[model samples]
Target: MEEYGYLWQLALILMSTKFLGLLTKRYKMPQVVGALLAGLLLGPAVLGNLLSGVVIGGHHLENLALHQTDFIEHLSEIGVIVLMFCAGLETDINELKKCGKASFIIAVLGVIAPLIGGGAFTYWFLEEGWIEASPDSSLFIQAVFVGVVLTATSVSITVETLQEMGKLKTASGNAILGAAIIDDILGIIVLTIVTSLGGGKATAGDSAPLWLVLLKIALFFVFVAIFGYIVYKFFKWWRQRDGKGMHRHAIMAFVICLLMSFAAEYFFGVADITGAFFAGVIISMTQEDQFIASKFDVIGYMFLSPIFFASIGLKVDGDAVMSMGWTVAVFAVLLTVIAVVTKIIGCGLGAKVCGYKNYQCIRIGVGMISRGEVALIVANKGIEAGLMSSAVVAPVIIVVIVTTIVTPIVLKPVFMSGNKTASDVPTTSKLVENYEQREKIGKTNR
Candidate 1:
């Protein structure tokens, strides 16, 4: 009976996500929005509790305990790993190299400004005794948590928007993509620092050694670099062999994904997604990357990604939001604005200083404003680590959702206008010669 109950819960989750995802697509919004709504509708604040006591043919729904929620959550975490892996796989190394200086400057400012702003805001509120936590709770910990939230800039939406606007190959698009990749790395480091400070067990003075933390991160990448090279060589040799079909290539890529994900968690103390990303990156070095990426994309978009977004909404405490009332609303708005504005000012100023045109700077800044799964994952980790409260997590979730939704809508027009102007300009012989020269240099390095 218990086993059957677990199956029923899983069925409900799948059905709800599929139904909501289809509905959202019909309205032209991201499928993620619909999936999240499904969770909200099915969760305790809505129909969940009312349906809690009801049973089908005397099979009590109460038998399906909340423990099943853990299954959904774990599945969602896997979804994140695969999603990040896909992102890394799609990244073009040459494109990133073109935006090198601008991307670095923007990424640095984007990280630093938010860290200071978020930390300052937390210190002011905590010092004023505004929160309900123990007075002894470390302000530094809370500030670090805020900084962590501010550090992420999810590029999925931005990339899609640029592609839709036909500006994906443009300078602004390249800068945005490069800056976003940097933002993800910075976010991970911030999370590592904050998690280390909190000591993982909520107790004081159990913090990991700084050297150990640095070693863990460094070693993870070193393993990836070395292992990645070996795998590429093996794949090249395999391609030279008689078995060069799709089946052989797919199996090899899948194995690499699993192995890298395992090593990341078990050996490096970094997030499994980080390892998965490196796995994808390594696989991407192969000649068959385009084919493999297409296969993974179909599976990821059709199923795993939607389930992950829905799970976030399901895990949220609707009752807590209502109970907190105005505080949650105010915090969500304030945090969302800060998250968006700081990224723009930081990345925008950096782009301008790096000699990009005004519109190019704006586009890059807007591109860095979107936050998605990465923010949610970090927030969830903070909750589990006891460094962040439910109150804090809820607002951060709201900020991520809002930024993701707005970035595409906001960036499209700016990108489109830029494209129109560039298109109207005639390609003179001198311009064509310069373009060919640059392409030659780019190809030579590759």
Candidate 2:
């Protein structure tokens, strides 16, 4: 009976997510937006309370007083991990290498500008007695919190929008994708540094060893490279062998991903998403990347991804945003403007400095402005870490939601208007071919 109840909960979540996802796709909106809306509609915010009495009939849904709401949240976390992993898989390493200089410059500026602007703004608004928060909290801490929020660039949403606009293969689109990938890498590093700082002491009144943290991060990469190479070689070898099953290889890949995720969280103090991301990158280098990616996609899109996005909507308190009234409204507007402008200035300057056309630079900046899952994950982590209070979290969430929703609408015209020819776009296929050729040559030499 207990097992059956659990199955029913899963069924309800899947049905709601699928229905909403298809509906959103028909309207040409991102499926994430649809999933989030579905969660809100069925969650405590709207339908949950209304159905609570009748559904439970004055008794808790589960023996442990488990509510449908709690179950959804748990499932959402799983959704997030799978989503991040899939996102990492989609990242084009070849494209990144081709546009390395422009992308790196743009990513650096984009990250720094936001960090400075967000930090400064938060210090001005929330540090003093202006907010009713505790006086003992230092301005620097608040500033760091704000800086952390600004560090993430949600490339997934931007990429999808570019693809939808049929501009994903264009110069500006490639530049944007390149810049966004670098932005994600840098953002994770910043997140680690900030989180380490916030953690304060490792022991009583003693700070965590900075060297140790740095060493751990370095070691993580080393393991990723070596292990990834071994995995790639093994897969390539296995694929050449007769009678090898695809399912066996797929399962092995998943096991590796999960192991890496656990190691990252338990041993390195990095986020699980970060670990999963590196795992994806490593697997991407293997011969089985496409097959493994396809297998993962089914589970991710059908179950995990939906739950993750929906959970975001479920967690949001509409009343909180409303009650804050003018403050929330004003801050949301200001933050949104700042977020967009900073990315433009930062990434544009970087691209321009790297010899890109002025228009191309601007397009790159616009593309980097869309914040999606990564930003939300960071924000949620901040709240969990107690680094961000309600006031800070509310405005940041509003900024993320608004920027994500608006970036596609805003960038479509600019991308369409660009005069750059297809030849101007970097070709990732050539890069990948070159890489593989080099690898083969090296093997021959050995």
Backbone clashes in model 2, listed as residue pairs: 79-304
What is the TM-score of candidate 2? 0.80
| lDDT score, candidate 1, position 267 | 77
Q: Assess every candidate by TM-score.
A: 0.80, 0.80
Worst 10 residues of 1 by lDDT: 426-435
Off by over 4 Å in 2: 1-9, 46-70, 129-146, 155-167, 200-207, 240-243, 317-325, 389-394, 416-446
Q: 386 in model 1: Cα distance from truth in Å?
A: 4.1
For each candidate, the alpha-carbon lDDT, in order, equals 0.70, 0.68
Candidate 1: pairs in clash? none
TM-score (C-alpha) between model 1 and the true structure: 0.80
Cα lDDT tens digits for candidate 2, 164-280: 565666666666766777787788778766665565222224445878878877787787788878877887788888446888977887787788778876787666667788778
Candidate 1 all-Cα RMSD: 6.1
Which digits, one per residue and each the tens of the lDDT, describe model 1 over residues 1-446?
65466467667767877888788667545566676677666765456555667899988764443322667777777777777777667555554455477778899898887777776776665566543332324767776687777878877677666655656656676677677766766666667556644554454555568788778777877888899889999998888884548767977797888888888777776666667877887887788877777777766776677777666666666566677677667767877888888888888999999988787888888888887767776666666566666556567767876887788788877665553456233333322233234335433432
